[model samples]
Target: MTIQNRERFLNNVAQHLGRERKTKNVERPSSSLMPQWQVFQHHSQDELADELELQCHSIHTTCKRTNAENLHTVLQETIEELKGQRIIASDDSRNETFGISSLYEDLQKKGITCHIWNSADGQYNLDYAESADVGITFSDITLAESGTVTLFNNSGNGRAISLLPRSYIAIIPKSTLVPRMTQAAKHIHEAEQEGHGVASCVSFITGPSNSADIEMNLIVGVHGPVEVTYILVENR
Candidate 1:
């Protein structure tokens, strides 16, 4: 075909493609305005704890090769063991007013070195947390259905406290426990939209850090904490 004829054919095809694209875009719904779905809710902290226990038990049973067993007892024992191994508890305003001080005192009497990093002092020192045997922090939210803890990096507790330590013990209040990750993520996303910016990092830790990267042999604490203890403060 002649050059002019080829140009006319290409222009017509481009126009047709543009019209089809516009039609598809118009048909699509706006995600921003869509109603956000709620994943899980609990009537009380006891119920949440029960659900968490069941889920953790299932994981422990299925991952039998890993020698996983009795998460509740493990968590409790870990806390006790950490007390003997030097543990630092991050302080928060909510914790101070929510009976955490008494808990800290109890832990201290047991020989745990609990440190209170107030809002005025601000931020966690990665080097300090790294040197510590264990770093304990509280989660803003937790998912009972999956035995997952949701931590906001920028809040009273930073990611370093959880990531830098050899062991991590998180004290989660029952009231803040959700059913699944979907609910937790939605809450965080909404918080970001409201100017919180979703913290620096959002960690969904189900268990201790582990890997089977070397010769397919399982190794724990390769990159992160070897032990992860979750103390569900049911009454509180």
Candidate 2:
């Protein structure tokens, strides 16, 4: 939308609400009582990983820990256990750092079809992801308290790569593990303050998709992947 049009729309809304149009950004208010900042704040990385696993169990998602040396084996075993035939992975460079690039080549040699996300391909990415047995991507930040993995979306990391697949796998670096959403938000905010570029869209996925409707009927896999797994690896 054009700036003029947006301003006019805001003015109209302000008129209806009996308030002046806000022309300048305001500083966010601060609270003295921030219990969120204290929860698990002092936990070590190992402790955070343990709490992450505990939360994963409650959410019905599998969490595994492996070092860089054994990540390839653990990933391969997980895919074999899932019986994945067609896999879709994000075009993320971290996959290479974690040895997943070579692993994909090996999987293809073993007759498992694999596709890495290509933004240029456009709609084909979506079509393939819809039929993919599994989707794999690296987590930007992981919340230990809720078993959540944060994905910052971009052209290379499309939303469909995580949302459309039958199953999803998040490769979590130990350094990315945080106490909760509060820490995650702080990291992003700090990045912004440091003039770092951040993705416009961020996804916080806790577990397999499930919903409880008005009548409290629980349904799983309604809007996204039926199964989700987290593979935690020590990055350093």
Candidate 3:
């Protein structure tokens, strides 16, 4: 209302505007003045895979190396190991339930009691899981750097199938096993952007669930699977 008050108000507004401009400038980096850095990029997929394989070997020694030709053999061997121990229960609800159908048939031929349950069926019975030896599931992706398998907990395959069982055997295509987590996150993010809703559950399993909580003694299979074997299928 008064001349002095009007002057003060105008000065305050000018000061606030200046501060806002300065804040934005401080937050933004000057592209022209920024230093350029070199990033070594691999040219071929084999080169990338080799690099990732080395990194993965450092973490897991059991990680098998194979091409598309031997993927079936690898799966067969893994199945044999489970059968020898008598710890495999194939859940073949849908014929499209990853590699379970084949596994189920193989076990059935051998007189193993592998049951098929429908996906539409109600929540999984805990007793079945408790009595079961191992659960088999398909992974959406695998990470070579950490030897991790990524599973989506959705309608096709419930989360309990992987968690409740004492042992989990995952079939993951080698092409899906990325070099790093950032790449994996980018893929998921892009999928979400394309209107596929964020996955209800994204589990990254590197190894069997274990804990050394009691008296500093290590115990496996205390919470989840005691053994986790991954059958990596290369691109065919």
Among these predictions, the greatest TM-score belongs to 2
Number of clashing residue pairs in every model? 0, 0, 0
lDDT of 1 by residue, 1-236 (tens): 54668666766887987852232344645576432333344336567677776776643311111111233344436666655355555656655544555666776787766665444545445556767778777778888777888877664566777877778877676677777777787788888888865677678777677778889987777777777766666433
lDDT values of the candidates?
Answer: 0.64, 0.92, 0.60
Task: Name the 10 consecutive residues with the lowest summed lDDT in model 2.
Answer: 1-10
Against the true structure, candidate 3 reaches a TM-score of 0.67
lDDT of 3 by residue, 1-236 (tens): 54668666766887887852232334645575422221123325555456545654443324455655665567557757655333333343423333335655676678665544346555544456555666766567766656677877665566666777666777666567566576678789999989987668898877677677889987767788777776655565
Among all windows of 10 consecutive residues in model 3, the one with the lowest summed lDDT is 34-43
Q: Once model 2 is optimally superposed onto the true structure by TM-score, how far is the C-alpha of residue 144 displaced, in angstroms?
A: 0.9
